[model samples]
Structures are given as C-alpha cells and as structure tokens.
Target: MVIFKPKRRVCKGKEVRFEITELDPFIWLQVNSESHVSYSIDGFIIDSQKKINGIFNKYEYELGTTLDVLFETLTQTFSQEIYACASFASILNTEYRIFIWPKDFPENFNIQDKLIISIKPVIKDKSIDLSSYKLVNMSALESGIKKLRGYSFSNVKSLLSANSNVECFLANNTGNPWPGDLDALIYLKSENKTIALIEFKTHNKNTPISDEYIGKYGKQDWRRFEVLYNLQNQLELAQNHKPKIFYVVWGTKDFDNHKMIKIDIISNNKVESTNYLDRPAFGESSMELFNLLLKLC
Candidate 1:
C-alpha cells in the first residue's frame, strides 16, 4: 500500500509576523498568537494623519455579531455624554501601518509612520507590506485585545489621580455588583462628577468583552458598547443621564508597561468615565477609561 505525504502550510499553528498591504483603504492590521490564523479588527483605524478619509477600516458591526461577542460580556456602562469607545480606535486609524516582528529583533530595526500604533509589544513596525500577509479577522482581534493589553489598576489610579478626580468605593452592604473580593472598582470622582470606572484585569486567562464581563456581572447585557442600550433604562430610572467611561486595567506584575482602553459605546462623540471597582491581580497595567460623570459628581 502506498501512503500519501501531508503537505506543510506556510504559517502552521504558530505566531506569524505580518504587516498590512497598505495604511490607507485599510487603516489597521493586527497579529495573532498563532500563525495562519485569520486576524480581525476590534476597532477601526482613525487615520490621525487624515491621509485617506471615508472611515477606512471603521465599519460598524451588527449588535449580535461574533466580533462584538467579546464585548457582550461587559454588562458594564452609565450616564454621561462621553460615550465609551475602543481606545484603540485612534491607533487603529493611524496612518502608519503596523506589524508584528518576531519577539527577537535586531536593534538596527527601523520603522516609522505618519500615524502611530498606540498599543504595541516587543514587535514594532511602520511599513507594513500587506501583499505578503493575510487580512486580520475576528479571532485575531480577540487575541489583540488580550486581557493583559490594558493599563494596570495602580497605574490608572496614578494617572487619573494626577489628572482627574477619583473615588475609592466599596459596597457598604453585601452583594456588591462589582467583585469587591478583588477591590477591583476604582471610581474616578471629582466632586459630583463620576469620571470613570476602572477594572484591573490581569489573569493569563483573558476575559471576553461581552461574555466574560457579562458572566462576571451575572450575565447581564455587559457588552461594552451594548451598555448604551441600558442608558435609557438608567435614564428612565432618573433622567438627564449620560454614558459612563470604562477602562479594563491590565498589568504584568511591576508597575511598568500599562495600557488603558476606552471601552467602546454607542452615543456621544467623546469618551467618559465609568462606575466600578475590583480587586487587584498582579502584573496589571492601568486601563484608562473615560466618562462625563466627572462633571456631575
């Protein structure tokens, strides 16, 4: 009996280094943990340079779609004109095409772009040759928005403390919505304005923006932008309510290498703060969230 040999693929089951074909038309490109995986866009690129306009790479998704599936876990938002949005939107829209180089790169590596890729790890680049790589799809976006991608709780505390008001709140009563066990909620408060809600997320096991957060908070509609859906409900409870800012604080143990993300929401053209708290996990970067509550509270 003759046995047939299996053909080997180029990027088989490994993290493949790649770049976008162009910075325009398509503003953002990301990498995944494994090679040969379809990469996706979490948020569209902003094109800070205004090189190619017409909302390149910034397409809206259907609410229940898989790309938003990760955000559904949020069960998180509130009153404020400042809508929560993907902090990376600006980065994604950058003019500079970004790419992932192998963890090991020669110091002589040179890269630059009119626009910058805000969140980058060991790998960095400017000229992304998309013709050589594949388009990043949904799964890749999830990997890019990894739990460790945001700012640390402590760093968020410091940044906002210096630039904004803050409130350290714990449930006076039991059964707090936030996981008080982690003391994870850091409310940025200034007088009546509730600046934002910061949650420190650092476990190696990343949480889905939709699934994890909703599950984290009793599986309510915690989808990041989906929280805007609750605004009417919250406003009906009162009135004159606006969107709240939210940040998923991420860290790596030491206070360095922190990233804060503006949780995406639908409404208002700006970013505001949120109302939340949680316990700290080691190796977390400060997640920067915004909200209009800061003006009120």
Candidate 2:
C-alpha cells in the first residue's frame, strides 16, 4: 500500500547483503536486490540452505504436508542459490537465522544496495499479517492456490506478444497479498500507449446460479466473484497508467448464456466475460490463449 523510495546502496561492483531473520513461525527478509532479484524473491522461500562444504540440502518434509507445500512452491519460483529458506527445523526450534554477507553469497549473483527491502511486522499469533506484508505470495495461502484455478497472469503478457504481437504482462509488482493481484495487464504498442486489465477464471464444472453458487454462508460460486471484484479494485487503485480497459476471460466446461447470465447479475454489469472451452493450464498455451486475448482486447 506504500511505495518507499529506493535507498541507493553502492555495491561498488561487489556482492550486496541480504538477510532472513528468525521470526518464529514465519521468516522475514528485506528485498534490497532492486529490480533484478528483489521481485523474484518476493514470494519465495529461499528453497535450500548451504552446508559448510557448499552443498545444497534438499527439503525432506512429508509430501502434501504444510511444510512440503511451502517447499514445493519454492521449487517452482526460483532456481537460484539465495540460501533463503523456511524449514520445519526452524519452526520446531529458534536457532536458525539467515545472514547473507558478500563472501558467503553465491558466485556471479549480482547484488545491489539501491533496492529497498521491506520486512513485514510479525503478529503475536505467529502468522504473517498479510496486509502488513508488501508482497503477495500466493503460496502463502496453501489452500487458496487451488482457487487460482491453475491460471498464470504472467503468461497473458508473455504469450500475447508471441502469438499476436501485442505486449502484455503484470503492470508492476504491487506487493499485495493473495487475491490482491492484477490478473492480466496488456500493452498495445501503438501511438496512444494503451493498457488493458483482464480478469481470468477457470472452473472444473459450471454450476447453475442459486444458493449453491452464490452464497456467503457456505461453499458458493460467489466467492470467486468476490475475489474478482477485489482484484479489479486493486488494479484500479494501484494503476496510475491511463487509457485502460477491463475484461474477463473465462474457461469452463460449460460456456453458455445460462451460466453467464448469473455471472452478469453478480458482477453488476461492471465486467465482461469471454468464454472458451479449451482453457489451458497455468503457464501453458500462452501462444493460443493469448492470441484469443488479443482479439478480446
């Protein structure tokens, strides 16, 4: 919610410093790598730790367990040897702390002091206060990851150019928590310099509009609608760029007027939905899917 000015740290062409402090149940680190590595580490668990002999240790937490879930996310996000880690061992005890100095850093890993890394304040409950955190780590919500429906907002930008020659991607790292992402942002490389904001959805099955689909009291389709509304607002609030368009891209088993009729009712005619039967999994089919997105744009 706040943009702190970058404090320039002269690395002097040398390795910069980063640290992960022991904050009990959660580990906190400042992102000072500037535009290069700071954004990459935003929602990552350092992935592994280095032994004194410089060997990387793999996480052996039980599969599908909470620890395993966190580690799996780390594997997907980064391939670096940042040595930033969140281990069950640390949660069980208070001994492990991360302090990255130049001599101890990975070779050829560039570091800069100009980057501003904001550390979130720890709550008494030992859980992260998502609002206080600058970066929105979808992995932080182990269960909610499924709610993303295996969609990647990044590919919208990447695929469009390859398929349709229109440039698009995440506007900027808002650092907002889960459900606080700008689903799709596209750039039209014309003289006007226009951008588009898109909301994408994918469902296994299309349930009819009723209490089963639109209730706050229990499992309902309205929950997804609510998240879309929040993401829309987040994009509008954070984006200062002008000449923007809003769109909704849906991939579902059933794409009929009956299903969308209810969606329009819930969206209050504020959003537009484009339905497709061949919805690709997250990070896949950037070429074809984004080609369709270009038409919608």
Candidate 3:
C-alpha cells in the first residue's frame, strides 16, 4: 500500500490538511480527515483551478440537467484523458471538491466503474475515550448476509423479510435499487439489537436554509426514514427491539462548537421542528448523538 504523508495547504484563507493512500485498486484521498474520495483509475492529475465548465455548459441545455445524463455524456465525450469530478460539503461544512483527469485512460472506461465516496470523522482531541463503541465492518457484514441468503440484500423488501443475527444493517445497493446507505447505524453490543439509525447533512454556515436545499436533502432523509421504519418493523418481529432514527445537519463550526441541528420527522418529509443540539460531535468519544442513542437503546 502507498501512503502519502499528511500535507497542509491554505484554501480560502483557511489551512487544510489531507492525506492520500493507495488501497489496492483504489486511491483513497481524504481531506482534513473528514471528507473522503476513492477512485480506481490511475495517473490522474489534480488541478485546483481547472473546471469542467465547458462540458457542463455544452450538455446542460442539450441533454437536460440530470446527473445520469451528464455522467453518460462525460463518459462519451473524453476518451484518452477522462475527467472524474465531484463536489460536496464535508463533514466540517467546508466545500470539498475533487477534479481529476487521467494522463491516459482506457477507451471503455466509465467514471462510476469503481468509485466510492464517503465521510468519516477523525478527531485529534483526546479529552474523551469511547473504546466500548466499535465501528462495524460493513463489508464483512454484507458478505455474511449474502452468504446466508444466497444472494445480495439489494432491496428494502429483501431486507425487511430477511432473518439474521446482525443487529446493524446498512443499505449497500449502488444502483439505488432501493434507498442508499444511511450515514451511521449504531447497535447495542450486549443485546445484539440495533438502537439508532442516523442521516447527516453538511453545509456552509452562510448557506440559507431554503426550500430547494430542504427538498434535496429532505428527499434523502425521507428515503432513510422509509428504511428505518421498515427495519424497525423487522426488528420488532425478530428481536422485539425498534431502533430510533435521527437526522442531523452540521455547519463549519458546528463540530468544534459542539452544536448541530436535529430535524424531526414530519409527514411528507418537510423540514420542520428543527432544533439545535448542544453536544454534537462526530467520530469522537464525546459524540452527543451517541448519548441520545444510548437513551433510545
């Protein structure tokens, strides 16, 4: 495995540090230890100033604005030098952007061939220790489920009907056959029962909480809600335990300030009953969400 030493750079007057690692066929790149990017293609260059504006402008009007069309067009547009790009709000609420083009790519290459994007919190603060809580290996869990069922748990219906000893379950369908994975799933170790299901949203502090943003993020939250509801029903039948679900959003200073917004589930997945949490922290021992989860469990 190839590992790059953590390096720091100044972005928009703020210092950002990141690391890169070669994890077998994929290049795992992480920014500030929170925002993660993974891709399988090799020999790509990262140009901060370069933008795929021309491609977007050319296709936005012609092919409609759906990401599916844009990605398909991108796959067909460039051959030798393929560009793969993604921009999202990091867990720290900073704008995390990645744009890379291969020095030479295969003619049959597709951008989504082996790309995985995820976020994880790695805090340097050591004021608290949470050794009791373990992060479950999702891959191993999925493999076990597949082996037992003789097929992948690719849909919500399949999962709702399945029987397993595994308490924490993650939706792993990449094709969106059902809802995608939730942000986090916490289970009771002693009882082997799921306790909490969480969905996270990150955004800049200055960004307004507009209807458009709510519609986009709320849709995702609603999908998670569906999964949680069904999973709870399944658990109630199997183990007589129903897990509580939460939706939380974070801004740039929210983590350090120990604050986050919790969204209450209402009918139609509309954004209402939003409230601030006092001890919000991610991937840390003092994570306030864990406290809430313990209460639910």
Candidate with best TM-score: 3
Candidates by TM-score, descending order: 3, 2, 1
Q: Which has the higher TM-score value, candidate number 1 or candidate number 2? A: 2
Q: Which ranges of candidate 2 are over 4 A from the true structure?
A: 1-220, 241-283
Off by over 4 Å in 1: 1-200, 203-233, 255-297
RMSD of 3: 19.5
Model 2, residue pairs in steric clash? 9-113, 9-114, 31-117, 46-84, 134-175, 157-168, 213-221
- Backbone clashes in model 2: 7
lDDT per model vs. reference: 0.23, 0.26, 0.31
Clashes of 3: 0
lDDT of 1 by residue, 1-297 (tens): 011111112221223233211111100111111211111221222122312111111122222233133123211211111111211122223221222221111112222211111212111131112232233432243233332222113222111110000011111111111111111111222212212223233322233222223234443434433333332234223323332433343322232232221232223323333333232332333221112222322
- The lowest-lDDT stretch of 10 consecutive residues in candidate 3 is 51-60
**CA RMSD, predictions in order:** 21.3, 21.1, 19.5
Task: Report how far residue 154 has shifted in candidate 1, in Å.
Answer: 38
Kindly indicate the candidate among 2 and 3 with the higher lDDT: 3
Model 1 worst lDDT run, 10 consecutive residues: 161-170
Q: Of the candidates numbered 1 and 2, which has the greater lDDT value?
A: 2
